[model samples]
Target: MSEPPPEPTSIGTWAKRYYYANRAAVEAVLRPHGLGSTQWAVLYELTTSGPTSQRDLGRVLHIERASLSGVVATLVRKGLVEQTPSETDQRQRLVMLTDAGRSVWKKLPDPFAEVRTVALEGVDAGEVATAIRVLERATAQVERHSFG
Candidate 1:
């Protein structure tokens, strides 16, 4: 008789488990600051890159413009970021971190760093790099299949 399916050890299963676990870890760290992971990413980008156009920020963050607009609006309401018309391109809005944002950035813990440190405690750098490449390839394949 034909054998049944193997145990659930697929890459997708592992990737999803890790995704949820990592997200949970991140949320736990940022919950006290009232920031979601996407918000944290936007703040981090502004802090490191200075003011950036909304279009450019969306591209850099790999987020949709509509989604980024909501995130930026939320930050503006929180007084964490400011949106100003670009001098060279009045049609474009540039997003920059406010003084409060800098303060919060300084105070916030690095969630990714914390999770990575603990998760890779026993794993070697080469293994980590290989895994990253594999995931990247898989992601690209999925993206191409869906959009291409």
Candidate 2:
């Protein structure tokens, strides 16, 4: 008999798998509002962070500039976002959610809550807290090393 295939090594791989799985469920919830995960993320960032430079928004979302440009364009066309040239730096664009976008955001159901509840169905609260702490620490370490 052939030997069993080796297991995947990186934690990042599992994290990505989890993200995609949860994203699919979230996408289903967002569909009625005519939004995808990327679009929703952009809107969420704008709502939470207030008006921000496009470059800064991309950095916050960990999205590539090119990909974010396309998403921003789509949101602009849909009347969900408005992009204006920055007063301080005319070359930079500041993106903000329109009133309609805010209204839609308010009306939409929480996309992650139900999926997260299902994911944590049997997990203990303490264990979840520990996992979150560990992940946050790891993310901070990565960012520190990455920038330095």
- 67, model 2: CA deviation in Å? 0.6
Q: Measured by TM-score, how close is model 2 to the native structure?
A: 0.80
| Alpha-carbon local distance difference test for all models | 0.93, 0.90
Residues 1-148 of candidate 1: C-alpha lDDT, one tens digit per residue? 9987655898987898899999999888889989999999999899889999999999999999899999999999999999999999999999999999899899999889998798889899999999999999999999889564
For candidate 2, what is the lDDT? 0.90
Model 2: lDDT of residue 21: 93
Number of colliding residue pairs in each model: 0, 0
lDDT of 2 at 114: 73
**1-148 in candidate 2: lDDT tens per residue?**
9986545766666667788999999999889989888898999899999999999999999999999999999999999999999999999999999998898889877788978988889999999998788778988899889563
Clashes in model 1: which pairs?
none
The alpha-carbon deviation from the true structure for residue 66 of candidate 2, after best TM-score superposition, in angstroms, is 0.4
Off by over 4 Å in 1: 1-7, 141-148
Error of 2 at 77 (Å): 0.9
